[model samples]
Every structure is written in C-alpha cells, then in structure tokens.
Target: MSKAEKTKQFIIEKTASLFNTKGYLSTTLSDIAQATHLTKGSIYGNFANKDELAIEVYKYNSGLLSKSMSRSFGDEFPTTMDKLHAFVDFYRKNWRSVFSNGGCPLMNAATESDDIFPGLKNQVKKSFEDWAGKISSVIIQGQKNGDLNEKANAEEYASIFIMLLEGGILLSKTTGDEKFLNLALERITKMIDNELNILPS
Candidate 1:
C-alpha cells in the first residue's frame, strides 16, 4: 500500500478502540491524535473531519467483531447446533480480551450515535439486519438438514437471540457482573437444545 493509505489505516486502527470506549461525540480529534501519536494536521489530512473519522472508526470496530464471529462460526464448529453454541462461547471466552476493549462495537455505536449521528445510526441498523440474516440462514439450513425443528421461525428466533445476547452484554457491562451474560447464554443454550433442536420421535 501507499504511504497515504497506510497512514489512514494506522489512524483508523489506533482510534477505533478509543471511539468505541469513549464514544463518537465524547471523543475529540485531540484524543485521536494522542492515541495515534499523530499531529492534528496529519489526522485532518487523512480524514475530512471528526464525523468522517468517526464513521471510519466505527466501521473498523464493527468489522473486528464481524470477523471474530465469522471465524468462530466457520472454523471451530461443525454442526449447526455447534455453530450456534459457538456464538455464546465466543463472547464468553473473549469478553475480556476482545469485547471489553470496546464492548460490542455495534451496540456501542447504536446506543451512542442513535440521536446524534444519522449515518452511524444507519450503519448500526444495517449491522443488526445483516447479523439477523446470518442467523436466520443458519436456522433455515439446520431445518433442511433435519438438525433443527422445522417449525421454528428463523427470523423470529434470530431476533430474539440478538436481543438476548446484546441485552446480556449491556447488563453485564453495566453491573460489572459476568453472570448476567452467562445467564443469557445458558438460556440460549437451553432454547437451542430443547426448542430448536429436533428430537427423536
């Protein structure tokens, strides 16, 4: 890559966590400069303005989460049930190392940018739609393979799963207790095993 491209990526990488943690409006160019060790002029040279920079940083943070979930779903799990379980496992295992850095970038962006940043709010919405689509597709596949109950509504189940998981994360972070998250995951597990999974006749 060219120097300009590399420099822009460096700024994005450096400021992604800052934006996620401190938020879009709360985070200023000065904070980014401090985090990236770049001059204000350099930051402005790479980005048009704070809004533009925040948009890119939000994308970067969201991509990190998407990539992690994709890797866990694709690499470590074989069956559909296993893949679903992997979602819970991914957050459980990486809450400290990965999630706590920013605490679910999509959720953070959605909550922080909803009223202020229209562009970011829309992106967050798209992220949720995309995630729900993925989960629904998996459920459809599982039903076709006779691994999951054919009667289960993929979209409905996907929506509930996302809500429960994200709510758990929020509660866990707010209360400084991992048990809330674990409880949600445990409930999801039971739903998967008892409600979604096909049982012998």
Candidate 2:
C-alpha cells in the first residue's frame, strides 16, 4: 500500500480502541496522535478531519468484527446451526470488551449520532443493513440446507437477534450488571438453538 494508506491505517488502528472506549465525539486527534506517538499535524496529514477519522475507525472496527465472525463460522461447520452458534459465541467473547468501551459501536452510534451527526447516523444505518445482509444470507443458507425452519424469516430473525443482543448490552451497561447481558445472551442462545432444532428434520 501507499504511504498515505499506511498512515491512514495506523491512525485507525491506534484510535479504534479509543473511539470504541471513549466514543467518537469524545476522542480527539491529539488523543490518537498521543496514542500513536505522532503529532496532530501527522494525524491530520492522513485524515482530512477528525470526523473523517471517526468514520474510518467505525468501519475498521466493524470490519474486524466481521472477519472474526466469518473465521469462526468457516466451512467446517457446514450447517446453519453451527453458524448461528458461532455468531452467539463471538458475541459472548467480545461483549465484555465492547461494553467496557461504552458498549457496541453500532449501539453507541445509534444513540450518539441520532441528534448530533446526521452523517454518522447514516453510516451507522448502512452498517446495520450491511451486517443484517450477511446474517440473513447465513440464515437463508441454513434454510436451504433444511437446518433452519422455512417458516422463520431470515431478515426478521437477523433483526431480532441484533436487537436482542444490542439492546441487552445497552441495558447491561446502564445497570452496571455484566450478568444482565450474559443472561440475555444465554437465554436467546437457548431459544435460537431450540428454534434451529425445529427445522424440518
């Protein structure tokens, strides 16, 4: 890659944790520079502005999540139930880190950007749609394989799964009870498994 591209990625890598932990609105260019041992000018030299950097960081974090999940659900699973379990397991592994960082990026973006940054909000919406598409595709694959019940709609299941997980995280964060989120995850995981078993077997 080019020097500019490398610098941009460096900024994103250094600041992704900051953005996830402190929040996009709360993070500053100086914070990223300090974290990366670069100057403010160096950061801006790569990013036109902090807003641009924040958007890039959001995308970067989401892409990392997708990669982890895709790896977790690889071809060896060969079934929809396996993929669904992989999804739940990934969250179980990451939810604490995500919550400590002020909860999930999508959840934070949904709450934070709604009133302040329309552009960021739009990006969050697109991100959700993109993630939902991946989830729906997996569910459809499972359905085709007769692993998931045809009566269950892929998009609906995907949306509800996300809602339950993110909403649970939000509440868990608010209440300061990590168990709240884990219990929610466990419950829904059980439900999803039960539903998965009911497929036309």
Candidate 3:
C-alpha cells in the first residue's frame, strides 16, 4: 500500500483501542493524534473529522473479529455444532487477548453510539447485521445437511446468539468480572451443543 494509505491504516489501528476503551464521545482527535504520534494536521489530512475517525475505528475493530473467525474456520468445513462452538471458543479465548480491558468493540460501539451518534450507530447496525447474516447462513447450511434441526429458525437463533454475546460482554465489562463472561460462554456453548446438536439416543 501507499504511504498515505498506510498512514490512514496506522491511525485507525492505533485509535481503535481508544475508541473501544474510551467510547466515541470520550475520545478526541488529539487522543488519536497522540496515539498515532501524528500532528493534528496529519490526522485531519487523513480523516475528515473525529466522527469519521471514530467510524473508521469501529470498522477496523469489527474487521478484526471477522478476520479472526475466518482464520479459525480455515478450509475444512466445520459441523454445525463445531462451527458454533468454534465461534464461542474463539470469543472466550480472545476475550482478554483481543478485547483486553476494552471489551468487544462492536458491543461498545453499539451501546455507546446508539442515541449519541447517528453515523456511528448506522455502522454498528450494519456490523451486527453482517454478523447475524453469517451465523444464520451457517445455521441454514447445517440444517440442509441434516446436522441441525429444521425446526430451528436460523435468523432468530443467530440474532439471539449475537445479542447474548454482546450483552455478556457488556455485563462482564460493566461489572469488572471476567467470570461473568465465562459463565455466559458456558451457557451459550451448552445451548449450541445440546439444543443445536441433538445427540442420538
């Protein structure tokens, strides 16, 4: 990539954590500039405003989750149960590493941007929709393969899964309890394994 493009990516990467940790309203252009070690003029040259930078940061963080899931899935097709398990396992394993003390960026942006920032709220909506669509697609595929019960609704299940995960992340972060996140994962994983899997008698 060109130097200018690299600089823009650098700014996004550096400031994403700030946006994730500090919230959109709390983080300032100066904070981003300071994090990226760029001058105010340099930052403005790349992004139109703090709002634009915040939107970019949300996208960058969401892209991280997307990339991680894609990387973990790899070439082999996972069983319906394994695919769902894989996602939970990834989120559980990466909760501290990827999220650190910041928590899920999508969840953070969804809660913080709603009723606060219109543009950012739209981006978060799109991100969640995209996540749901992917999960729903996997569910439908599993149903077609007879691995998952046809009675189960893919979109509904996907929405609930995403909602629970986001809520768990928020709750865990709000209460400063990582164990809440683990408990949430445990319950979700069991649901996926038991309800979604349907073991033979």
Top-lDDT candidate index: 1
Off by over 4 Å in 1: none
Which predicted model would earn the best TM-score? 1
Greater-lDDT candidate between 2 and 3: 3
**Candidate 3 overall Cα lDDT vs. reference?**
0.82
**Superposed Cα deviation of residue 148, candidate 3 (Å):** 0.7
Residue 90 CA displacement from its true place in model 2, Å: 1.6
Which runs in model 2 stand beyond 4 Å of their true positions?
199-201
Candidate 3 runs further than 4 Å off: none
Q: Evaluate all candidate structures by whole-model CA lDDT and list the values in order.
A: 0.87, 0.80, 0.82
Better candidate by TM-score, 1 or 3: 1
Question: 91-164 in candidate 2: lDDT tens per residue?
Answer: 78887677666678887877877869787888899989987888888888877877777787889878887888
lDDT for residue 197 in candidate 2, whole number 0-100: 52
Q: lDDT at 103 for candidate 2?
A: 71
Write one digit per residue (lDDT tens) for candidate 3, span 1-201: 999999999998888788888888899877877898989999999988899988888888889888887654454646767778888888777887655738787778877888879999999889888888988888898899999878888899889888788778878878878787787788888777777776787
Worst ten in a row by lDDT for model 2:
192-201
- Residue-wise C-alpha lDDT for candidate 1, range 1-201, written one tens digit per residue: 999999999999988888988988899888998999999999999889999989888888888788888775684578998998887788888887655686888888899887789989998999999889988888899999889999999999999988988999898888888898888889888998899998789
Q: What ranking of all candidate models by TM-score puts the best one first?
A: 1, 3, 2
